[model samples]
Target: MEAHSVQVREACDRRAWVRDSDRSSCKECTKGFSLTRRRHHCRVCGDIVCHSCSATVYLRNTTSNVGRACQSCARPSPDQSTPPPAVYCVICLDPFAAQSDALVVTLPCQHAFHRHCADPWLATHDECPLCRHQLSQDRTAFLEFISF
Candidate 1:
């Protein structure tokens, strides 16, 4: 089960979030929300779910997790190596779909994000989020790379 969980975490793009107001009940159990029975979003499919219908998944193999996933997405897919439309802009928690017109950039740390999202972030942070490696201070190289 641990190995399956690892695969599920890797194969699933668990960042796409659903707007809270979009759902009125759990997609799995069809349980309506109340003050006590709150709705939870499945990190994988972005489906609104109940606590019993969702299971906590650790994407980073850490003690803490980003959120829980519904039972459907928690199961490892048969062909788990190939994930679909999974590239996402961590800044906005939005997926970078293949057909999208958004410009994407990959930092030295290998983390990829939309160019628009990353440019502003790089200007302020001057470092990669996944890796603490500071980007080169040379503006000429950076400018040439982005202009491409």
Candidate 2:
């Protein structure tokens, strides 16, 4: 049974993938879409399927921690890749706060914040506000990268 399930999952993963925007109907059941019956994509195969035909699967291999997968691709395939940390400015409580400002600064940990907001906080502290990640190094590399 385990081997059979694995085969089914592998077959699903090998099926033709579709982008989220290109999906029209349920790939598995060929069900025509409606207002209530929304479309969902299988994380592994990227097939647009109906909610009833999809299952919530923990995506251990990809950046998304959890996502919907078709019945055939429901099996988990764990990998060693680490997901990228979510970017949000702690001071402004916004994801694109840095982009809104003229001057932006990114920490060594890849967390970004507006230069004006970060400078005051960084002047007395040596840690990130969001994750509390330590900032022992200077901001030369980050400054050079964003130089306009």
Candidate 3:
């Protein structure tokens, strides 16, 4: 009985494999191509990145394959090189640098929020600035403790 089940599973798997192989295509242009001829598409934007064009990205302390971004459309301008610091306000997704007071505060959760942005933010939500981890709103309340 077990042998019969295993044989059936193998047949099913082989069919699926063939189906996938038939569907394989170029990552960028989406034209049908072979692995030897086609470059991997970038996971971010699904752009085709040939061998010379692919860029490797290291994420989550792990190395993963990523296609290189083309020069003109590639992200992170080398000439205008800005620090790769987090830009969005954790609380509002607003650009952090544009705040008038430069009063963006980093919550213990490693999330940054505008001092004013956080006060009202805290009233409705008591989480980390970025991931919204429930924070100590009443316990030894410090920082921009909102009165209202």
Top candidate by lDDT? 1
Question: lDDT by residue for model 1 over 3-108, one digit each (tens)?
Answer: 1122225323445677778888888888888898898877667778898887655343322323467888766577755433335777777877665466666654
How many angstroms is residue 44 displaced in model 1 relative to the true structure, after the best TM-score fit?
Answer: 1.8
Leading candidate by TM-score: 1
- Can you write out model 2's per-residue Cα lDDT over 6-64, one digit (the tens) per residue? 11122234246686568777888988888989987676677779988976543334332
Clashing pairs in 3: 28-48, 54-68, 55-67, 55-68, 127-133, 128-132, 128-133
Q: On residues 52-135, what C-alpha lDDT tens digit does candidate 3 reach at each position?
A: 444333111112211233222344334643434556666567776653555665543445566677666566665665676655
Candidate 3's TM-score reads 0.32
TM-score, candidate number 2: 0.37
Q: What is the C-alpha lDDT of each candidate?
A: 0.60, 0.56, 0.41
Off by over 4 Å in 3: 1-84, 98-100, 137-140, 143-148
Ranking by lDDT: 1, 2, 3
The CA lDDT at 18 in model 3 is 24
What residue pairs clash in candidate 1, if any at all? Answer: none
